[model samples]
Target: MAVEIDTSAFTEEAYELLSELEDSLLELEERPTDIELISRVFRAMHTIKGSGAMFGFDEVAKFTHEVETVFDMARSGTLPVTKALIDLTLAARDQIRSILDASRGGPPADQDNANRIISGLRALAPQKGGAAATETKAAAAPKADAEGPHVYRVRFEPKPEIFSSGTNPLLLLNELRDMGQCRVVAITNTLPSLEELDPERCYTHWEIFLTTTQGENAIRDVFIFVEDDCTLNVRLLTREEEQEDAEPKKLGEILLERGDINEEALGKALTPLGDRLVNAGVVSADKVRAALTEQRVVQEQKQQQTKAAEVDAVVRVPSTKLDKLVNLVGELVTVQARLNQISGRLNNQHLQLVAEEIERLTGELRDNTMSIRMLAIGSTFNKFKRLVRDLSTELGKQMELTTAGADTELDKTVIDQLNDPLVHIIRNSIDHGIEKPEVRKAIGKPLVGQIHLSAVHSGTSVLIQVKDDGKGLDAQLLRRKAVEKGLLSPDAVLTDQEAFMLIFGAGFSTAEKITNVSGRGVGMDVVRKSIESLRGTIDVQSELGKGTTITLKLPLTLAIIEGLLVGVNHDYFVLPLAAVEECVELSPKDIANSHGRRIVNVRGEIVPFIRIRERFAMDGERPIIEQIVIANVDGRRVGFGVDTVVGQHQTVIKNLGGSFQYSDEFSGATILGDGTVALLLDLARMVRYVEMQETKETGGA
Candidate 1:
């Protein structure tokens, strides 16, 4: 029976390789002489081609093979790394992605585009019989051999079940032989008799002696896919050993290097080593033969050496599986909460102890599960490099993207949703924030503008900023535009910070004319909505001449959050624990002293307050003594007045459907211990909404 292949796995790996290929190709254009980058590009394409063929992505394999051949020529210095080459290769990478996408029921890739790229590459390739052709032939010679060919001893001990995975060891051996002059010896010590042998299982391993100039990485690339299922050791036989005085390693040394014998065992053995060890039950005949074969091969090359070993075990898991796991964990958290409520009601010591233990484990599990979903934001950052490069070229501007703290991790869900908003920000920076090269020179600024994209951890939040040093947001111009668009009154007086925020207002643009990229006035508003939907906030800081900086403050995860549960009359609400500062009592006398103003004095600081019950329009009389939950909104201190403080709760956020989705005051809702639903407060948006209401009440102050 034939084994069925999972084409989706192949497509996924191909897509990732294609992405890395694009990044490598772009970097190659910057450092044309960097051999490592070239090798990386070649490896990515080679892996895609090899895996594509294996998974029957015939068209992908065929197209990639052509691109790979061209890159191979470049790798060997037969072709120079040119901007034209990078362009063609990038186009080819896109075509490969399109092909993979087509396989997933998307639009078919354009065959004409693929052919054009191939033709362009062939045109760049060195032709036969000219000076360039002769130069190419000379360059094609083994580069490593220039320093003298190196010999290596390789041992491949494949897992017995390799055959079940559709791997053919013979093909791997052939690939090794193709690289250089190689000798292979198969060991059958573990093979059973016919009656006990399993045809589907691999029983044999092999030893290989090879003299090659492809370098170690290329050798390892041959075994890349099977590395996880086999014991592979490749050791260099130093060139000095080839000298007249150098000798092959001793039998004991060979055995030790093969891990078949230890130094102590060898020291205890007598002469005629192999026969002595076998007779003494220290070695088997098969092991002795394998060692002798290695000894003979080394004699031809006259060298021996050893290398240390390191292994990393990795298993690729589908993101869907992780999502299911998180969902199950959320359910478990809910169940654990129910148990805690029961234990509290029963007042049973043993039951309370059990509930406490379960609660601790559940919290740990939730953290671990969320950690699994936390991916480095760098992958998202790398993609923007291409966007910046393309936009700079398209708009005739000179700008570069510099990034920091890319290793900052966020939940995969948030990261995925974050891409569009980031793209919009970067595009705006390129089109509006960065100046054209000539314009910059005229203004005495650097010809190439800089867009600094950085992220850093702040408490339980990640702060991502896109800053640009160009003609910054003109606060006066923004104010005037806001007035003209009726977003602000002519008599309105605003600080520079407030004026800068006018850009996020819908249909607000300072551009004199519209362009394909940004002037339609749709991006920043969408950005604000997207960030807020993730329970995040966006801030703007800019100067007249220097530049503009947009900062996004987002939570570490959206799945589950530590929330401060508070009660307003009969209903409960949760404020993100990270945002909650302190809670205090608000007596009716304090309210009377304030003359009905929604503000409280904490210490010497006057804090503005929001009455949750009034804001949500809940019908209930005010409590004689209300509790005030002081929280940080943006950078200001604010208080949320509620009936009581219900303590901290680990909230598994559940999206509010139907009409609740339209409410800006609550980001989401969670189930309480007693099965009641508690709405999560969107403090930033809530503050803005209340302030806007007050502004209207005060006649556009």
Candidate 2:
């Protein structure tokens, strides 16, 4: 079969590598002296350059080569890693991304940016420097001399599909030639019939004799990117001490040197048995030495093949395909639930056994599919490092962002939608929550502010908190702003927590002046809407003179939920199981003692309750005995009044119709096994509405 060469595959791999490259650059800035990080940065750039040239991204390859050269100098310790070098490298990284985009017809790269970076790099790391280049070359030569010069016989044979990956075998040969003296002979015996030839497949291999003062490590570095893409072998023909005086011998030495002697033994033997044993196994010294050299090259090649056979390889699958598999698993879950219900009602032993087996299989399948979709949230968090760095510089603030719980995992879909909302929240923290350096110093706080972002798994959800150590929100000022905007009555009294929440209201802003970053009042409002759309909740906690923490609670996945199915006067509803804390009985005496307030006293804790029937305007007679489901809402325990609890359900949530989509009381509706539609309540919205009503009633009293 012909090689399936897809340009999109190359682009996808390039994008993933670029993200890693950006991450490495940011890390290198923090630890400039780390050798491993330096190596990582160099390798990333070299791969991008080589792969770009192979796939027709000529401009990308050309621009990246210059960046690679800078890092190469860094790896050799010829050029010190400085802040200016880091900045220019970052700019070059962005320019490469622009080139990739332009290659695929997104837009042309910024020529000014490319030129500015190239100019900066050239100014700093030039080929011919007056004193620095001389010092560097003099410095690097000894490091090589310490290892001693050796002749290496390298055989490079790329897979037939190497062209598809954008690699040119000739380019690799050219790199070998640059290392020192290299003789290359291309073998075209693998060439196929013209009728059967594949244009993209490589049909040639090369045998190379490289005489380099650089040692074996240097030769291996040339083929690092193609480690898995080709067959490579580099064998040493001389030792350190011998190579001190052992440059390649004349043709006469080639025909007379003995093969049995190791380099150490040969050093002394070369002077004595100079013409005794030319080759080990053949009669003619010239032809035998040639054959034995080929034998060692092939032997080293076999060792590499043997080593490669032991490794387990993983293939990359497209995310779209994984998404399809998840959807299929969801449907299977629904069908399995239906089978369970039927088997329970029929009471047939055989049918019941089959249903149990199907349930077990379905559960395992669902778990496996979920595991595939789960990705560590750290990747998302790492991207914000650059954001914080750039913003801190732009705003002229001394602040550090500390993070924790990076290993927490979330659904890919949820993480994708979370980026913009999180950006808005973080920007707000920097602009409004964190005080300036002078202001902070005047208030006896540290000169540099601290912004801490943390994520942790809570029940079936993940809680992400973005906390800042700066000026806390002034509750009084927020109340005043709410009154001016008509969001609250002037006489309305609110708890500190309630007052802090007013920032999420539309057109709410306490900023005295507008700036480019966060003062326009469009941020928090949209943040609330976006979080609510994901069936999540956001809450704020602050002190008078201390810092503020904003917490977001979101489900691990959006498609399926573990729900508590309930019935209120025959209308069904589903409550997220993560939110449910307990179930309690609502007594008549408790209601009478509260004097018209809907509440319950549970183990010395008075929790406010809301009747689902009244909230939805469902017409039903009050049941004498009722069940109250206690849940944690906004960090407080609240209760929901329902008629009966119908056990747990694996709810496959579906979107609401267009007319009902605007309503905030319910997030979405789920289909039940019996074909009944259960509306999934947005508990946060209902709790907020309930609190507002109680505040008004208490004010009247």
Best by lDDT: 1
How do the predictions measure up, each by TM-score?
Answer: 0.78, 0.73
Model 2 pairs whose backbones collide: 54-166
TM-score of 2: 0.73
Q: How much lDDT does candidate 1 score?
A: 0.85
Note each model's CA RMSD in angstroms: 13.7, 15.0
- How many steric clashes between backbone atoms does each model show? 0, 1
Give the per-residue lDDT of model 1 (tens digit) for 203-231. Answer: 99998888875778778888999999999
Instruction: Identify the runs in model 1 with alpha carbons over 4 angstroms from their true place.
Output: 1-4, 128-312
| Each prediction's whole-model lDDT (CA) | 0.85, 0.79
Residue 126 displacement (Å), model 2: 3.8
Winning candidate number (TM-score): 1
Residue runs of model 2 more than 4 Å from their true location after superposition = 1-5, 102-107, 127-214, 217-314, 442-444, 585-597, 601-606, 693-701
TM-score of 1: 0.78
